[model samples]
Target chain A: DVKVTQSSRYLVKRTGEKVFLECVQDMDHENMFWYRQDPGLGLRLIYFSYDVKMKEKGDIPEGYSVSREKKERFSLILESASTNQTSMYLCASSPSGTGIGQPQHFGDGTRLSIL
Target chain B: LAKTTQPISMDSYEGQEVNITCSHNNIATNDYITWYQQFPSQGPRFIIQGYKTKVTNEVASLFIPADRKSSTLSLPRVSLSDTAVYYCPLAGGGSTLGRLYFGRGTQLTVWP
Candidate 1:
């Protein structure tokens, strides 16, 4: 079965601290994405990558950056964590195609808390 | 990308068929409609997808009208487990990359 795993399921950090969230997919999909989900606002895209070393910003990319040094691994970085950044972060990957019809496999998200 | 609109919430009884409709008036020719189910605290899972006509799989059925202006996702004899937030995503045009946009999906609650 295809699997997407996150490095951490939960994390707590102090304000102004740097944070990283790691995601790995076993399906070898070419596209990976990071999103933050908040109540009423829904899931907002942060960034996505089509290949190694390639990335693009989504609707809301502020205060976040991404790295895809390897095909199966994608990392999301919080430059300096803030209390407003507290939310559930999800990582997803899909095959390289225009097929929005294709299902994206997702990792069990990381719930981050910044004080 | 085409924008989709769906109900904010709906209530249904167990063992009843539930149909949730999504409207995408500006859907392009190459765009396909995809439905996803998301439970609380979990990521959304794909339920069905279709370009035109009726498409059915093990989990659910997708029905698209001739005009392609709207689509409906039909769940057969829904159970309490069927309660979830259903999102309808519109695919980008031909040869474009897979960039998914999530809208405020419809929340379905199945009761006994």
Candidate 2:
């Protein structure tokens, strides 16, 4: 089975703290993504990488950054955690190509809380 | 990316077939319709994907019209476990780098 592993299932941080969320996929997929899900706003994309060291901003990229040091690992960083940033963070990966019809496999998610 | 609109919620009972429809009026020519289902505490799972006509797999079916303006996801014989939030997203924006935007999604509730 294809697996996407997130470093933490739940994380809590104080305001002004820097945060890191790590994701690793075993499928060797070329595309990796990070999204944050809120209660009624739905899942909003934060960042995505098409190749190692290549990253693009999604619709909502403010206060977030990403790193793709290796093919299988992608990391999301929070420069400064804020209370409004508390949400469920999801990591996903898919095969290389235009996502036209390609479905992404997602990790269980990391619920991050900022106080 | 083409924007998708769906119902806020739907209700169905066990053994009943539930259909969730999504509207993407601005879908481009190269775009494809995809659906994802997310449970209460887990990440979203892929349900089905289609470009046009009908496509069925072991788990669900996707019905797309000729105009590509809308698509329906049909889930047969629903049970309590079938309850989840279903999202319809389109792969459209100009770049082919696997970028997809998601909407609020439809919340389906299957009653026992």
Candidate 3:
């Protein structure tokens, strides 16, 4: 079984504060992704990394960035947390391939609250 | 990625088979259909994937027709734990890399 672990399950931060959310996967998959889930919006991709030190912007990447210093760990950084940033954050990892038909393993999401 | 349309919600009883259908009218030839189940407050879990015909796994089964415009996910004899949101996303093909576009999934509620 694959295990994707998030650093926190519930997080709270004040406005204008920089927040960091960490995720680690045990499957050694080559692709990692970060997403934010909001009511009525579903899951919106924030950032993704295909390999270490390589990252791509997803549909919603404003005010957010990602870091992949190692193969097993991916981190999402909120440059300046705001009330609007409060939402559930999810992390996923998938194996390397043509990206066709590959199953992604996800971690129990972190519920972030920015006040 | 092709946009997928599924039901907003469904109601079923325990010990009954549940089938959720998703439509992707603009699905490309190389695009594959993938199903995911997400519980409340948890990330989506991959259930099954298929290009055409039928593909069955321990969790669920995927059925796609020849036109590839739609797919059905069948959960056999579902239990209370099977209640969750089911998402059908068109994955892969062309320059999509691995980005998956998830819409408002079908919320399934299994009752006793």
Compute DockQ for each candidate against the true complex.
0.68, 0.70, 0.66
TM-score of each candidate structure, all chains considered together: 0.96, 0.97, 0.96
lDDT of 3 by residue, B56-81 (tens): 98988999999998899999999999
List model 3 lDDT by residue over A46-74, tens digit each.
99999999999998999999999999999
Candidate that beats the other on TM-score, 1 or 2, i.e. the better one:
2
* Runs of candidate 3 exceeding 4 Å displacement: A99-101
Per-candidate alpha-carbon RMSD to the true structure: 1.2, 1.2, 1.3
CA shift of B12, model 1, Å: 0.6
Q: Which lDDT tens digits does candidate 1 get at residues B1-112?
A: 7888999999999999999999999988988888989998788887888889999999899999999999999999999999999999887756556877778899999999
- Indicate which candidate wins on lDDT: 2
Where is model 1 more than 4 Å wrong at Cα?
none
Q: For residue B42, what is the lDDT in candidate 3?
A: 86
Identify the runs in model 2 with alpha carbons over 4 angstroms from their true place: A99-101
Model 1 clashing residue pairs (backbone)? none
lDDT for each residue of candidate 2 in B41-86, tens digit (9 for 90 to 100): 7889988888899999988999999999999999999999999999
Which scores higher on TM-score, 1 or 3? Answer: 1
Q: What overall lDDT, based on C-alpha atoms, would model 2 receive against the true structure?
A: 0.92
Question: On lDDT, who's better, 1 or 2?
Answer: 2
| Winning candidate number (TM-score) | 2
Native-to-model Cα distance after best TM-score fit, residue B103 in candidate 2, in Å: 0.1
